[model samples]
Target: MTIKIITPEYVVFEGQVDSILLPGKQGEFQIFKNHAAIVSALVNGQVKIYTDSVPEKYSKYFTKENEAKSAYSFAIRSGVLEFNNDKGIILAE
Candidate 1:
C-alpha cells in the first residue's frame, strides 16, 4: 500500500509501504494491503512504516527502527488517518 504523512507545512513522508502501524484514538491498529477502508482520529504516538527499502529522499524524516532499516517511525502530537483502495493518507500535527 501507499502512504503519505502530511503536515500543514509540508509532506513528511510519501511512498509505497508494505504496511503501517497507526495510533488510533481507540487504540493502535495495523494496515496492510487490501485492508478494509478506514477513517480515524489519531493520538500522540508513533507511526511505524514498514518497507523493504527506504527512499533516500524521505529517509531523513523517519528514525530507523532497527539496524537493517526495514522499518521506520515518525512521531506526532495528533493526526487523522484515512485509508482506502490500497492507499493511506495521514494529516498530522
Candidate 2:
C-alpha cells in the first residue's frame, strides 16, 4: 500500500509503505493493506510508517528518532487521515 504525508509547504513523505500507525483524534490506530475505506480526525503525534524502502527524495523525511524494527516515523501538529483500497494519505499541518 501507499502512504503520503502532505503539509502546506510540500509533500512531506510519499512512497509505498507497509503500514501507518496514526494518531487519531480519539486514539491511535493502524492502517494496513486491504484496509476498509475510512476517514478519521488526527491529533498531534507521530505517524509511523513501516516499509523496507523509502524513496530517496522522501528518505530524509523519515526519521530514526522514533524508529522501530522496520519502521520510520515523524510527527505532525494536527491532521486528517484518509484510507481506502491500498492507499493512505495524511494532510498534516
Best by TM-score: 1
In candidate 2, stretches whose alpha carbon ends up further than 4 angstroms from where it belongs are 65-67
C-alpha root-mean-square deviation, each candidate: 1.5, 1.5
- Per-residue accuracy of model 1 over 4-80 as CA lDDT, tens digit each: 99999888889899999999888999999999999999999999998986778877878988744688999999999
List the candidate 1 regions with Cα displacement exceeding 4 Å: 67-69
lDDT of 2: 0.84
For model 2 the local lDDT of residue 32 reads 85
TM-score of 2: 0.90
Q: How many residue pairs clash in each candidate?
A: 0, 0
Worst 10 residues of 2 by lDDT: 61-70
**What's the TM-score of every candidate structure?**
0.92, 0.90
Please state the error at residue 32 of candidate 2 in Å.
0.8
Overlapping backbone residue pairs in candidate 2 total 0
